[model samples]
Target chain A: MENRTAREYYENYLKTTHRLGRILTASVLILLLAAPYVIGIYLKAMPNIPAVLKAFLGVGIVYLVSGIVEYLIYVPMLGAGGSYLAFITGNLINMKIPCAINARDIVGVKSGTPENEIIATLSIATSSLVTIIVLALGVLLMIPLQPVLQSPALQPAFENVVPALFGAMACKYYRADRKAALIVLTVMTLLFVFVPSLIGSTSMMVIPSGALAIGLSYLSFRKKQKTSEGGNEA
Target chain B: MELLAELNSPVMYLICGGIILFVSVICIVFAVRAYRAGRQLGIDESKMKRVITASTTFAVLPSIGILLGVIALSGSLGTPWPWLRLSVIGALHYETQVAEAASEAAGIGGLSIANMTPEAFATIAFLMSLCIMWGMVLVIFNGEAYSRRLVSPSHPEKGGKKKKSGMSGFGDTAMTAMFIGLVSAYIASYIGTIVSGNGMFSFQGSWLPLAVAVTSAAAMGVFIYIKNRTGADWVDSFSVAGSMLTAMAAAIFFGRLIG
Candidate 1:
């Protein structure tokens, strides 16, 4: 009887903490979502809001927008609840939006408490908002000094940063289909290198051309398959 | 000499091209992987349908966006970009350029629209701009498609209970979250322009600001990296980087036209 009572008390305590975390997460998500409009209205109302506040507000707005975008575009297209949950949680955690409950932890909480549904959703949204705001803030704070960055000597190194970052990211997702990956990479490189000169710009054609190449390869595969089937029958 | 210096920035083109290439390669790699996965699943002709749907949707939209951008750029350079309605977008874009130039001429910390006509600015509001920015952000964020479906089996012999609640519905929540995120980012950009007392096209003039911009751009990637512990974390980072590259590229393209 004493052991039963102790177990009940512990369960109650866990439930209470879980509920509290949910509430906090939900509130933060709502605030992050509302932040853009709040800041927009505030800026419009009191134009004299200090530069630092304005900067933070600007950052907050970015986070808010990012949250909205993730909610709207991906959630609808993905259709699966687990996938959606993963996306929300992944976005929150990856975006580095700090929430009391780590996004990955929410997946584990489902077995113990049914309350994780709200916690997972809210925490994911909150984290995404936080990360987006920081990104915007970083850029907002950086734009006033373009001329110095563009100096002839500094240009080469500064320009390498974006591509280098992209390269690091790309290497992380190498395709299992080595041949297909190599073909795509080669075609994309040629487009990036040659098409810009041919079209006198690099902005648009690389993607379409690469896509067309992929399409043609698929067609060839289909034809080969059909030929093999015929040979087998004959 | 000053005008020539502005025009001759070759690094600008290199940066722009490299970013585009990065985006292209990322998209292509994913498309190829997706195709292989579909084939491996051996869903018969259904796999072909998925491929067709994905290729048309993912590959087409960005190509159109880029084509529009190239045409706009050509117009900026006073060269014909050889596309449909080239003149119309070119002219509207030119007006956009003029407005930017006029705003720039007004000078930093100069006459903001609020300062010149406070009442009119208050009355107009940024609802329209907000709507437009939201739309573009939506388009950019939603371009890549990742979806799954569970159809009831065709054979009566393989009967099973009909799915009452289709797909966990987490995708809807994700879409809503992403929309909110992009909208927040858009709002941030707008507010940043106001706070910085500069137009959206303003460039980073020094290493400090450049470093800041680069870090900010990477922040989105870092966020995604942390969220995805395994299995395609790279795509998340690429998406973030892609969005930033798009913004930066758009700003430069506008600056050239306007400045």
Candidate 2:
């Protein structure tokens, strides 16, 4: 009886959230419609697409596909119009090369509204489109280089780049949230280094590292609270 | 010892040292920038130091492992051993597949893993496995979430609040690192495969490719760290520079070695 009551309550909660989502979706759609026209004249008068247009197109294709996905999933089915606009703009933001200063504007307006929900829903959709487009352009742009992504052996080398980039970012992150950063970084490092040894060659190291980081960070938080309380009493 | 001996080769040392040095210098520069940015942002200094320490460790250790692995493996084998190489590549490919599959299995989160070709499946699996493995290692070592605040020097999140960096953007760095570390490896493999016309471990020229692969892996690690620290602007410049250098180095080194 108690379990049944809980389930019933959950269903009611879900319905309320659903209704809320619909209202938010409508708000975002309204915002999106106004965005382009506001800047459309300037967009029209803009100079020729830079040679970087090719690169933008590469990422843009991916973003476009992602937008299409959003259209199908949210705009059409879920009735999320505002997300459609956010998706379009997000891709545009990503496509800008050398420095697209528009990310702030694109993602910023999302605060404290139904727009945030829609944007969150469309994030992956936008990323997928952008990634695919960028890759296509990358292939064409990098044709002169030849065999960079094509060859089998070299692909592994390419795989490593993402992690290195993350490592660099980790350094910066560490500087900001020292306690949490140290805890997570240390946890991940241990995972990357020791897990392979423990589980043998077949084991995947990164997952454990990421998990460990999150876990340890959580525990450390509790430990910190305990210590701080003890100090207060002393 | 023999592995160390081969690593001592001027060319090999140059490759290893140069790459490591490049990465270290980039990290140091970025760390300083991050420090300044944090200072400007009013992040506590002690907090910044801890983050830096964690980031440095994360960046350096995996990289050293990868670099040393490449140098040692290459030096010892003198030829790319198909089985070992295949397994490593297979692992990466498979991990990626697994991640995709897991996401898809969640329904609406990803494309169906069942639909992927064998190669694609392997790739996803490789990525997923790596993530899992690394995550575990991290937990065992220190047990933290590895979250970091990103204050875009140029683009701040809404209402001037800082945004947190996630692992999603590391994909770009992975691509760059792969090119840098493995172009020669790719060329070698392509030439060997064409010459031999064999399948499943037929590609040759083990050292160059392995080195590239491992270094690229290192780059992925470092890039992740860097992306979290610097602005996208910085990432773009660094990526372009890294890619160009990787291509140039591969061209020069491969030309000399294979010529």
Candidate 3:
């Protein structure tokens, strides 16, 4: 009875949310897919279907595997509102996910709450808007700042954004639970060291690594529970 | 006449701008829903406001990286395409490669379509959008389902209580595990990059990236400590961003030093 009202409340939001999310996301996809072809037709430069398919497969096959992995790994982090927004707006692991997590942490909201959803939605939405604005600014400033942007001085920074980001962010989780973090970090390091080519395929490797972490955490959970139960018995 | 003379066509800008406008409109509607829902849940309006401000601040730095990405792509495809693609669904990493692959398939030897036929440009555009559709499809149809699976994952009802009091501990461990897993997968690549080609294992190349990663972790450590001692959660809020900026600066410094 206690949770019934809240659960029902969440379910209500879920209904309207799913309905709106699907419609909005679907529309964006349709527009994006059609834009290229429509432009081609108007310009009398319609894409050759064979050429399109060949080019697509060349790039598509890897993402075909990697994309699904990202959705599975990232959806839980993004929630419903954030998902529609992020998938449509793009830039997940590097930008939106970090923004959402920071927003949630700032307010100390746990995951899976309406509050968490709000923080994530607000953060991601805010970040996306910021990104678009920055891009618009970049479009205007492109010629003026062209030399600075392409300068060798700044090349290393942009090239290393992912490593710079994850290195800092990972410390938070590692502090929270050393056992799980250590195991995952160790395995990831060794795997990457032995098989350096795996660096290009990091997105694809998320599942296997995440599974190993989940499995280890579950074991730790069971161990803690068993010890606590034994303590109570004693 | 000089504005978009060569590759920056007027029509391209119009279409890209329209798409950006469409996404912004949808974004506002969703934010309103989440905002109202927050108030209903007894969340302080001020707290939500802070999340907005902090998130916006944090966003500025990473968005700079994305800006660099746009600039790189523009050199090849021109401004309108990268601007629209990156602003919408494309990532900084994927768009360049996707364009190159499509261009190559179209028999444009190099990735950039500078000497491009309109047909080749269209093919590249079409392919970039097509490859990214996988995640968007799931979000449209399966987002809510994923959330349901996430928030309540077969951890017995425990008197059917609505609060996560019962499974919060379980949730903490499981969620931590998953996050660490994802982060490790990404971080590992940096380690691999350093060790494999030339660092420890090969002994043939530079490990400047490895130094960047270590410096980043150290900076984060200092910020996290400041957060604990000051009890100013803002320090924690900015810790990750702070660390990233420092590390990026270090990359330039270290790149000059070693690599």
- Give the best candidate by lDDT: 3
Stretch of 10 with least lDDT, candidate 2 chain B: B143-152
Question: What tens digits encode model 3's per-residue C-alpha lDDT throughout B189-236?
Answer: 766776775544874444666666678889999998887788886675
Give the alpha-carbon lDDT of every model: 0.31, 0.31, 0.80
lDDT by residue for model 3 (A50-98), tens: 9878876677988877878888877766777888898898888788887
**lDDT, candidate 2, B128-214, per-residue tens:** 222223212221222211101211122233222322333222322222221222222222232333323243334432344334333
> Could you tell me the lDDT of residue A59 within candidate 1?
35
What is the DockQ score, from 0 to 1, of model 1? 0.02
| Candidate 2 residue-wise lDDT, A54-167, digit = tens | 323433343334333323222211112222222222222112111111111223322222222222223322222233333223323444533444454444334343332333
Candidate 1 residue-wise lDDT, B61-169, digit = tens: 2223223333333322211111111111111222232223322332323213333322222111122122113322322233222211222122112122343233222
Task: Tell me the DockQ of each model, to 2 decimals.
Answer: 0.02, 0.04, 0.64
Worst 10 residues of 3 chain B by lDDT: B152-161
Cα error of candidate 3 at position A38, Å = 2.3
Candidate 2 vs candidate 3: the TM-score winner is 3
